[model samples]
Target: MTEKNPSQKTVSSRQNIRKWLLIISFLLIPVTIFYISPIVAMMGAGKGIVTSAILLYILLFVVSLVVARLWCGWLCPMGAWQEICSPIFKHTVADGWRNWIKYGVTVLLFAMLAFTFISAGGIHAVDPFFGTVNGISITSFQILMIVVIIFLIIFAAAFFTGRRGFCHVLCPIAGLMVAGRKIRNLIGWPALQLDTAAGHCIDCKKCSNECPMGLDVNGMVRQGDMENADCILCASCADACPKGAITYGWKKK
Candidate 1:
């Protein structure tokens, strides 16, 4: 056999590394949000974790721009929850309901964003994870705990039964993040794309099955479409690809 292209192999290895790191991050986000630091320390200066300062949200935007939703894919606790569900539930129409929930959540996030701009508390109130983690009231804490339990159960059930259920259907945060990325598609950072020519996909449907957001990764690749802006970029699709068709790139556009 001819010598392996070292650079190509290196890139593939890096892609695999990022994929696994995203999974690790998924496990870490919730712990960090709840226990470590409600808001992760940014590369730049910042004071309060969740302040009314537009700068904080702006900082989030910059982070998203730089990482291109990799945070959602790898480090979001909620995403991890869904990814856990993927192995539990086989792909089904039930997942369709969960996937559609994002539309309603998308509206909700925009509504909160607008209200927060006016009332200041709107965004904070609707962020379920944030509310659950940092609530001051005992009743609120109980509610958050219940919500967390419900999501956990959903994840566990989905895990045993089939594929992702909660994240694809009920996760408001995933919906919000996807909507934000769609509104600003050019992430201006490194990203992974499914390349058609690689034909690496064996059409095993693992990517679709593994997707916490419940996207049709194989179909999207075959159609030459990457319109599913909600993609977590978890690299589950890339990981499952047998032919190595899915590749990482700074920008496919």
Candidate 2:
């Protein structure tokens, strides 16, 4: 009997995990909004929920620092929605330029904060997801429904053009999460690499195909450069490697 390739097996495992995570997020969203949205509203109304909301936000921030946007990948409802659309539009390209959206989102958030502190407290109205979800009454959520439709459409376009572009570029929560990851040493940064003759990589290009980001994973592996900021630590490249030589770890200091 022929032995199965380890790299292919790894890729399959990672893809399975991604699929299951997406499914779990779909099931978890309603409960999350039911439990958390009220607390947010109460906090805004100065009804003692302020402390609870603050605590919750802090806890989430700490979690982000530790896991580096893993929540965005695995738990966020919008993320799950986007991932569901990814496979439907398969023409993707790696566009590192899209990272510029992070800076724009940061600026926009600060602008909202300034407006909230100085003028009418309407910052929440501008957050697309928040606005969409809470804009109308539960019985009359046409606006929110429309927003969802638009979001799904845009996500589908991005997925077909470039997978996960929405999260990498357009999502404000992801911007915040990425910032938190940069400022903290509390969470260990996961690094992926190979231990053996990395330079021998023949550029078979399987890793890039497997990567959600459409990154040159094979090139990075050849250069032993696993610490690239673009790396999501999903281990897709390791899964796609035909050679069992690919691995992930802390580089020797």
Residue 213, candidate 1: Cα error in Å is 4.2
- Model 2 has a clash total of 3
Task: Pull out the clashing pairs in model 2.
Answer: 11-239, 89-160, 193-247
Q: Please, what are the lDDT tens digits per residue for candidate 2 over residues 1-253?
A: 3334556765677669877987786666543442324224333433212223333445556775655566665556666776676676465555566767756875675454444434544333312123224432232366347446656765854664577766666654555556666664344454222343575556677777876666777777767765444456566666666664466444331
lDDT against the true structure, per candidate, is: 0.51, 0.55
Cα error, residue 50 of model 1, in Å, equals 4.6
Model 1 lDDT-worst window of ten:
36-45
lDDT for 23 in candidate 2 is: 78
lDDT of 2 at 129: 29
Best by lDDT: 2
Question: Candidate 1 — which residues are off by over 4 angstroms?
Answer: 1-31, 34-61, 65-68, 92-98, 109-150, 153-162, 184-192, 198-214
